[model samples]
Target: MLSRAARPALRAGAAASSRAAAPAATFATLREIEGRLKSIRNIEKITKTMKIVASTKLNRAQRAMTESRSYGETSNKVYQSAETKPLEGEGKKKLVVVCSSDKGLCGGVHSGLARFIRRRAATEGDNFDLVILGEKAKAQLSRTHAKNIVLNFSGVGKDVPTFTEAQSIVDQIVQLQGDYSEVEILYNKFINATSYEPTIIEGFSEEAFANSPNFAAFEVEEGVLPNLREYTLANSLYWALAEGHACEISARRNAMDNASKNAGEMISKYQILFNRTRQAVITGELVEIITGATASADM
Candidate 1:
């Protein structure tokens, strides 16, 4: 039972098993780290590409926004000169049009609009009906104000809006069944490259426009006032869409840039971990070999 041959064989077998277990566990950990590093690097690439695309689109969106702003102002001059204001006429409810985009990955661009609506409901009371423009707002509002939604449009905010799209939206709105006293358009106003705020544009009903105290002062233009309603609504809608698109692009670019930076940080951290783990593995193997040789020599 105490034979030298059996003792040496037992010692070598025990050493082999212990050494094998250590390397297996260490190698498994190494593989896991490598997999994580690869995934993070891929994510970084995606975010950087997204940032670049958004940057490219931002310029065109801003240009369209500028032109639409001037166009909207010119169209509103008649009403502005006439001092037209929205009236709370005869117990009729007001309507709100929330302008938002269908896509996400831009920070709070859609949620901000939804938050503004909720804040208004909390302070002003939920008397107005909603007409949401984008799927994002529709989903967000449908949770709380499902009953208040009167109309909604999808597939919007994919690109810079055209006048025809605005006209089509207005046509559907005009056909909706409800004699709203006033209509208000809510959208994100682009303030700067990195800032946006929720703003409202007043949309008056025909009766309110005609009944304004200063409406009589405007020079009597034949047949112009009759078509002005649709024209003004479309112009304002197009302006809102353009500016909102610019804000979305700017926000997306910023969001993607931040994501890419975060990914870079993670990659750096994991790379360091990988290097340290590899070094430890090598050292462990050398230690096992040296210990085995010394043990064999003693035997």
Candidate 2:
């Protein structure tokens, strides 16, 4: 029922629509694949850089932690021995020093430490106070344990945590002991480059100070024990800092490695899709070209 002229126009319209749809479909496919590739590439770069930075920091942190462990062990032994002779002080309250990292992007290092603190608090009742190191810890603990937090220290990084910094924190803890009964440290201990374990260390109140068998070996002059006590506090803080740093580096390294691997897989999948889309576009063009040549030759 259609006129000849109208039939040609309709066929032409259909051809145009088909041609347009072909390229649009191909273009859309290519664009989607390309976008994913770009995103994956960006993620890859970030993860690679993070891995390198973590590796560098890991070495230094490990060395510092290793060097400090001897001091930590010796101090613990000394403290155990010193528990024999009772000294003068008053009251019994418990203080906890929790160490974490200032920054995130590592996995659950901060959350794990916070969980440990929460569990301990639940078990220990409401009598304990907290001295938190790191912004991450503050943020994590603020939700539920904010009231127990007595102080927060932030901005500790890859640089060797200074003796002065440790001393100041220790001084604050000692001051708190005058009001409280006891002091304890909760932190991640560096077991290896890949592993860190949370641990708790306890310090005695002034009244509970005693001379034990280990203390019996070293005869100290008057006023020396007080100086040694300060040293012990500082040393413990230093060890905690080193161990926390090591744990941060380890977590970061693992996170980055996983990110990089995922990025690589995404890039591969996108590359395959892009190649298939381009091939489809080429095939469509070749079919149109061959059909046109046959018509021209017949004419």
Candidate 3:
């Protein structure tokens, strides 16, 4: 319904309306972006804290693992020197222990270990049964290999994984192995601050048990070495716990770093959008003022 003379004015009004909308849109977008950035910053803070905590824990864990490794190695050497003892009866099953974290937000720490276990289960066949150490591992492994899972223990956290805890799980494994063939542990090994890899540690085979030369070289009384069996079991479990803790920290650090990078990118994008919107508003106002001034001069 606008005449020729009014058309320019109408178009200018619409442009002004659009220009007004630009600032609002920019503000809304900025708010959202800022909110996200804040959230990411918070996440980064949390992850950074976790990383530091993990680092401290990792140092302790590494020391524990290192100390335990010597015992395990010594045990292995001794077992190797000893003659293999035949299984007294028909029990012969493979037991697998899976170690993971109870908590999440550490990136692929849980999934990576779970994937490794699932792959091994597929290839290793039905002879294997699982004992899970963490809730994450329990939840994940239960999805696919529920049938193969024999026992589960949760609530392990940053504390030094004790021999008591190991004894509880090891006793079960020993009982199962007494009826089966072997026992193994699957866990993450911390290679460095930025890297972790899955590892599997296996117990001695029946043949290895029988043919080990180091076992024969031991001069201890027969029953005296029985106590050493507990030590060996505890050492192995401690190593797995230490390595798992280290992996957790490394994964958290990487995850936080990625989050921080993503936040930076988002903040930059929103800033560009705000600048463009501001420029559009200024250009619209300048055009309106110039048109009005020319009309007044002509009048």
- lDDT against the true structure, per candidate, is 0.90, 0.77, 0.69
lDDT of 2 at 23: 87
State the lDDT of candidate 2 residue by residue for 158-250, as single tens digits.
Answer: 476666778887877666533655567788877776777788776655444534445556676546766777787678878787777788889
Regions more than 4 Å wrong, model 1: 1-4, 219-226
Find the number of clashing residue pairs for candidate 2.
6
Give the better candidate number (2 or 3) by lDDT.
2
Candidate 3 lDDT by residue in tens digits, 1-299: 76888877776668667767756775676567567657766765765676566666666766766676665566555554574443433446677788886888789888998898778767866667888888998898788989988888888754766657777777765565335555677888877777788887756544435445555566656565546665565567767877787678667667766766776676677667656766775676688679667755754
Provide the global lDDT of candidate 2 against the true structure: 0.77
- On the 0 to 100 scale, the lDDT of residue 162 in model 3 is 63
Residues 1-299 of candidate 1 have per-residue lDDT tens digits of 77987888897899899898989999999999999999999999999999999999999999999989986777678678878887766668888999997999999999999999999999989989999999999999999999999999999998889999999999888777888887888999999999999999877888878877788787545466646777888898899999999999999999999999999999999999999999999999999889989988988
Q: Once model 3 is optimally superposed onto the true structure by TM-score, how far is the C-alpha of residue 206 displaced, in angstroms?
A: 9.2
Candidate with maximal lDDT: 1
TM-score (all chains, Cα) for each model: 0.95, 0.85, 0.76
Off by over 4 Å in 2: 84-92, 210-226, 287-299
| Number of clashing pairs per prediction, in order | 0, 6, 20
Candidate 3 C-alpha error for residue 153, in Å: 0.9
